[model samples]
Target chain A: MKNNSLPTDVEPAKTDPRIKLITAKIKKENYKPDALIEILHTAQNAYGYLPMNVLKFITKALHLPPSRVYSTVTFYHFFSLKSKGEHTCLVCTGTACYVKGAQLILNEIEKQFSLKPGQVSADNKLGVSVARCIGACGLAPAVVLDEEVHAKVSSEEIVNSINAKIAV
Target chain B: MPKISVTIDDKKLDVDVGKTILEVCKENGIEILTMCHLKGLTDVGACRLCLVEIEGVNKLLSACTTKIAANMIIRTKTEKIKRYQRITSELFFAERNHVCSVCVANGKCDLQKLGYKTEMNHIRYPYLFPECNVDTSHPWYVLDHNRCIMCTRCVRACGEVEGAHNWNVMNRGYQVRIISDFDTPWGESVTCTSCGKCVHACPTGAIWPKAIVQGQLEKKPEIIGELVEKRKMNL
Candidate 1:
């Protein structure tokens, strides 16, 4: 049977600063396997998404199995295996938001940019997604553009905002 | 090991303390419907079919995971449990494409047996019909996502018995999937030993040998528990 362990001496590419950041975080955690989730959080924050190679690095460093690492990464919603693109449009489809035409905003965005929820544009400029709720229910039919909440905005206004950001 | 008294379906009996309600019921020949449960493997209680109502407890607990307690009053065949089991069976059918007529495990599938046991006449909920992939990447086995019930039996069997954690669950909710090593193709899995333990662990046609055809697939899930027992004998 083949050994699944990687040599401790083998390190990830030294040129990438993001790797250095992850290595530092792992070191800070003392390379304890129990801190796997904490280490994953640092890696995700550095790379915006958990890339395969980075995941492999963590697996090797923690002396954990590949499936263990991958399973943990895939379980949580906060972690993303794929990039969320340069600009993101997150529409809230909570009971309150859906009651106030949240689906219409989603439709308008899909019509304008040809991007559906959980889909990224071919150019990788814009990505669209939906949330159950962001707890901003008072702002019914709310849309989030690049981490900034656009409260009570019409579908046309949201589309124009996305166009303005991604066009640049 | 002292025995404890418990009343199950109005039948009072003295059973072992550490044994689960399901284990006690099974030993005593009390019928309790279950899925996602296999002997000799760890009990995860993923399937809610084994739910039994306990006196003073508001919610029904799974028999497989809940241990028997002293002077406990347990009811397994209540009308509420029957209703829930039927609902669960219907949801399992409606969640994916379980076209039994075309399935390889058609007549022998546990899911089909479960439907019969629960008396599932027809599904009321709309079928999700999510486009699932059938991975024929392995040289000897095939992994069909459509037939999967998200039971972690294969995952546990691979990890605990085979000592190869090749199988793992990815994503969540309706989008959950059984992925092989970083969601890559099974044939390309660096960790998989191709032991075929997962084939036996699977309760559905989600994983099966490539050689079999419709209704011809034979699975010996009992071998897994027997294997564990035999290993303890050190023969």
Candidate 2:
């Protein structure tokens, strides 16, 4: 993937394919300023996060004010300004989940990776985060690695699942 | 636009159909507390302060964004509204490190006035104590995230009024921050006109001129509205 429209500030290799995908998405939207959210979603797909240069590129390409774009990005829970790790881990902290030892699981993940919520591991292998609720109360405590839901995850099973999945 | 008759807090008044409930209330001298609202900018409804009860609506709606409809019964001073207002004010204080005792906008802050208006004695919720940044990179201004409630008035004012969209938000939830030109230092921004519109747009001491000290910031937010009004005249 190559983005001919990619901004110069970013490196050529890591940003190229994503910028190409993002550019395609922008073209698909016809570069409408009001389509900021949709474009950001596509950018996340391409780049894993909304990089500063990419955001700047989008603001210019869409002809929207930079502040407006920024405000919208930060206001939404789904948006992220940083890159996700090769493996993404999400722990639900809903009332049900919390009571079922979600906190312990979260703590273990942090301990295992030495990374906090919203932080990627130094090795770039794991990204740790917490969700308010995943609507999986039956699972009590759940961990989502990538799109696959690990329901009813016990505190003891947390580390093993993350390590096994990442190893695969 | 057609005039719609509506009852706001038992007072019947005919207002413009397309105008928002907050605008109607403002025209009729009904004070609805707000923080994210700036007369000159677009309303994002981020702040829930102007929430009012209306007949037939089960949930309270923010007055700043909802348009006035015919025969709508709006209650601005309901017990529910008052309770929520207090909770909202408390949440604003609890969500950040808003230590007003030593703040620059101690006396002039709208958030403080909102606290007083809501009669918020002390916060029941635990303080978030989020480690926030104080950006002094700008030569003339300081961006103190400690006092920020994320009202986004500065974001709107910078974009809609000054036409300099330098200020934007970064992150999510209580971790959100107002970033200048894609999370760069304010002094290093290429788009910042250094207009200081954000300083006036802020309801709290999160943004202030660098030269100002504790309890000394005197912001005139009305000037933004005045400027907008003047622009309409096309001078």
Candidate 3:
């Protein structure tokens, strides 16, 4: 593939020294091909979801096509294309979990939060999604609160769990 | 050639410098289980099964792609490595529509063998019964999307090895999938070489010859290694 020389669609960073510092550090690391995912993670941690500037800066630094970068960003689920809330709740809807009533639990969560799957609650405290099995089937009907798994749960149990998290 | 001394599974061996731990282990008959790694392809390191602890490296590095250094200490079968491998294999089983008994690749699938080898009797994770379409559109092959592991070996083989650029991954994360170019159906994709390379490259029964659907769903051809090598030369 030819190296892309065209200007990128992602916006350039604002004149913040912190941004400059981060970019400088990334540049110094030399952005090896294998480090692409890690770089995206670091970029998101620093700039929240990959905004135009971060994407453009990454493109310019890596000398990669902007579309190629964007496609990669879209390929991996770990990379978020949009901003996330303070807390995200992922309900496992994999077969084992589903057989154990994962959907019912998810419905209860959505009802209590007044939102649908993959939506952020009105209060912005929780973001909900129905995930594929997260490899915790031993704990079927598992709900991931942030990154922690609460296993072998029921709809009522999930409601209580969310209420507890919200209270804290 | 420079030599690097590394300890794996407590056995000390000196290996030629610059080879990945995987190449060394394979050459030395030290088995560290892995999938998503076909020799000589770009190591995407998607499967975390080959992770091993390297002294001074905090995170586990993939043996398939990480180059060896002089005097490196590595542990391949530590409790942590075993646990992670089991978890990743369990996840693989849970995420896809792997009903082995009904599937054509039941006896010959690598995932099935891995499950047996890992002693995973039951899926601890929930099963994902994602709705899938089985495409028997191609004249010579059947594309069963449901059985796909999404390793993209076929896509890589088609694009990088075959020079057809016919296959590409579409979507992200769990939703990520292999697609023929232009969102066209497998039967309709214009770029496909009809070389049957992707079908043969598949690890599961996701792609197989159409005529042999019932009795002919066979293990991937062992010739894939040579095919990959030949394609590299041609490319």
Docking class of 3: incorrect
Runs in model 1 deviating more than 4 A are A1-12, A89-132, A136-168
- lDDT tens digits, residue span A1-168, model 1: 111331233455978899999889889999999999999999888876777778888998998878788879879889887877789889999999999999999999889988889998888798899999999999998999987999999998998899899889
Best by lDDT: 1
TM-score for each predicted model, relative to the true structure: 0.85, 0.76, 0.60
Candidate 2 residue lDDT tens string, A69-116: 876877886777666787899999989999999999988877777888
TM-score for chain B of all predictions: 0.98, 0.97, 0.93
Q: Which candidate would rank higher by DockQ, 2 or 3?
A: 2
Give per-residue CA lDDT, model 2, range B1-235, as digits (tens).
6777899999989888799999999999999999899888889889999999999999999999998899999999989999999999999999989887898888888999999999999899998898887999999999999998888898888888998888887767667788887566788888899999999989899989988787667898989999999999996
Better of 2 and 3 by TM-score: 2
In model 2, residue pairs whose N, Cα or C atoms come closer than 3 Å (at least 3 residues apart or on different chains), thus clashing, are: none
DockQ of each: 0.36, 0.35, 0.08
* Superposed model 2: Cα runs more than 4 Å off: A1-29, A34-168
Better of 1 and 3 by lDDT: 1
lDDT of 2 at A4: 38
Error of 3 at A104 (Å): 26
Worst 10 residues of 2 chain A by lDDT: A1-10
lDDT of 1 at A102: 98
Residue-wise C-alpha lDDT for candidate 3, range B145-179, written one tens digit per residue:
78888777787777666677667766766776666
